[model samples]
Target chain A: METAFTPFTSFGGGLAIGLGAVLLMLGLGRIFGATGIMSGAVFITSRAELSWRLALIAGMVLAPVTLFFVTGQMPVLNVPVSPTMIVIGGVIVGLGASLGSGCTSGHGVCGLSRLSVRSLVAVPTFMVTAAITVFIIRHVFGA
Target chain B: MKLFYALITGLVFGIGISLSGMMDPAKVLNFFDLAGTWDPSLAFVMGGALIVTFVGYRLVWRRDAPLFEARFRIPTGTAIDRNLVGGSALFGIGWGIAGFCPGAAIPALGTGRWEVALFLLAVTAGFYLRRLLAPMQTARAAS
Candidate 1:
């Protein structure tokens, strides 16, 4: 499939992201952490908050799906890993996001912007672990 | 009311990222294809983020306190020691290996992209490692 991904398009995307992140922080006094959002949807039993959580997630899932329909341009990615590896990987990330108390957006973007020491620590660790894992998978294990 | 605002704003943010092309992993992957063709998309995204953040931080600082909170919780410690350097190095390595950082990876998963799942798993594992070692690191510091 032909793709027209360009830097100009990304600038528009970045603007939205920056604005949204700032609004969330100022409006709700909460951080934008995807792992935390997922965890909240699953673990939070309060009915009052459930719909909002689900909506936030639905928005995330739906936005791209909708875009794919409108533009006929869903991102094309090639994955060489088996389903078992996928599950293992998801579990690892879920745990890491939880332990870190934020994902990349929370720490890397929002937290880093705030100069949070904890984020400074967590973001780098996340980056290094990802690199080493990728190396091992592609080179040594050939996964 | 607060929750309502959060949901609406969050959805808008998610969609903005998608439409702007920041959430599309394939576009990001091109940047990692440094040997074949230099993709400048990453720079745009970073530039956009920095621009927004530069202004947003200043605005936030002048407020005397966060809009929804009693105070802005800046990190107290001023020292740039081991934790700072080590974590940052690790994060850069992870980003180098997996083109997807934490925030982007979460959205990518919605597209049924399994590589993101793998990346997430590593992120989760990293989180746990930090948690498990936190106590020991603190103890070692005391001794």
Candidate 2:
């Protein structure tokens, strides 16, 4: 797959993400953890709140879609792995996020900003583990 | 007023990160191409993030509590115990291999990447696994 980078585009994406985190934190009195949002949708009881959650999730899922359609510049996939491996990876990440009580957004962005210790630990843990795993896959196993 | 400001701040953060392109998977993947053609774009992203965070923290630190909340909610513990280390290791491995953390993964799905779907599933599984194993791990440690 071909890949390139542009400063303006990168800046736009970051701005949206940061703004989303801030908005979620301020309005709902909650952290914008992806896993948490999924969990809330799965478990919450109220219909009104459920709609808002659904809307939030929808926004996240659609934002890139809109970008792709409008720009005709589909985001390239950098991963080189089988569907099965990808699925396996997803399951593992899901479990980890739940165990950690938040995903990157909740902890990495909101939690870290709030200076939550759990997030501080979790963010670096996420970063380091991911780095080592990449090393092994790309170098050691040659996968 | 505090809550209002918090909401506005949240929006700014969310929009800001998105605009910065930090949410884009391909852009982030460029950071990992170190051995071949390493993309230095992420360094810029990090630089921007650090500056934002540094300034943001400095300003926020003055207040006893966050604008919308009762307390700042900073973590009290400073221990780098087993839980922190182990959890981080797992997270790093996943991210290194996949090149997508939870924050970026969700937006990636908007681009119709099957791999993003797979990674998200793994993340979910990891969360549950941690929950299931936590008690046992704790019990074993006690003994």
Candidate 3:
């Protein structure tokens, strides 16, 4: 599929994300980090703590499905990697997100917004590395 | 109340991710492809989110505590260690390779695509594996 820059959609979606994050912080007193929430839902020892996490995941899983009903179209997805590459990428992402303590949502949006110093350092590191990796794969290897 | 709040937050977030075009791997890849056909839409998404959260957090922090929680569950780690840097680098490479970060990946499952299912499985495995390895790492350090 051909790529296009969508400023309005991006901005609108961003506004929703920001509103969601703010609501989470104010209502639940928690950072809206996907990996952290997922991990907690799956691995937490206490069942009480698990309820909200599961609710969050359930809501996320339902959102696009709801959108499909409302708009009569499935959300656009463009996974361009091979099976092997996808597995490798997914594993690395899971491990890295866990080890790094946050992903784009936690570090990039919420953490940065909170003015966390660690997130300040992390965002640039990942962004630059991601840029270089894309350059290597797209230009150098020509994959 | 907290569960309801979490559900709403997740719903908003999922919608935002879908609308922002972040769910599209091609768009995400284009964002990373600075030297190629770079699309800056994700920047606007991030910018919009940052502005809202930046202001919203300050307003929320003024409160003594959240409505449903005792206190905020904020990360307190301040040190910049090898784990943070290395993990972030790994995440960046994975993101560059697959164009699916945690935030995008979860909601992508709503698309019911095989590739997304595979990626989700790998991500779950990666999270569990990290948990499995954490104890060993701590033991090795103690030894």
The 0-to-1 C-alpha lDDT of every candidate, in the order given, reads: 0.59, 0.59, 0.86
Candidate 1 regions exceeding 4 Å error are A1-5, A30-59, A66-108, A111-143, B20-26, B60-71, B74-77
Return the top candidate by lDDT.
Answer: 3
| Tens-digit lDDT track of model 3 for A1-143 | 35888999899999988988898899888898887987787778798789888888877878898888888877788777889988888888888888888889999999899888888888898998889999999999988
Each prediction's DockQ against the real complex? 0.31, 0.33, 0.79
Return the top candidate by TM-score.
3
Model 2, A1-143: lDDT tens digits are 23465655554454455555545544444456667777666657787546656666666665555555667665544565566766666665665666566656666766676677777888778766665565566567866
TM-score of the A chain in model 2 = 0.85
Chain B, per-candidate TM-score: 0.77, 0.78, 0.92
lDDT of 1 by residue, A23-119 (tens): 6556544556666666666567797547656766655655556668778877445443455555455445554455446656667667777777777
Q: Is the docking of candidate 2 incorrect, acceptable, medium or high quality?
A: acceptable
CAPRI verdict on model 1? acceptable
TM-score of each: 0.68, 0.72, 0.95
| iRMSD of prediction 2 | 4.4
Look at candidate 2 and tell me the lDDT of residue A8: 56
lDDT of 1 by residue, B1-143 (tens): 65556656665566556655555444543454443333566567656765775577667667666565566644355455565555545554445444555566655666876566666666666665666778998899999
* Local error of candidate 1 at residue B16 (angstroms): 3.7
* Candidate 1 C-alpha error for residue B123, in Å: 2.5
Cα misplacement distance, residue A38 of candidate 3 (Å): 1.1
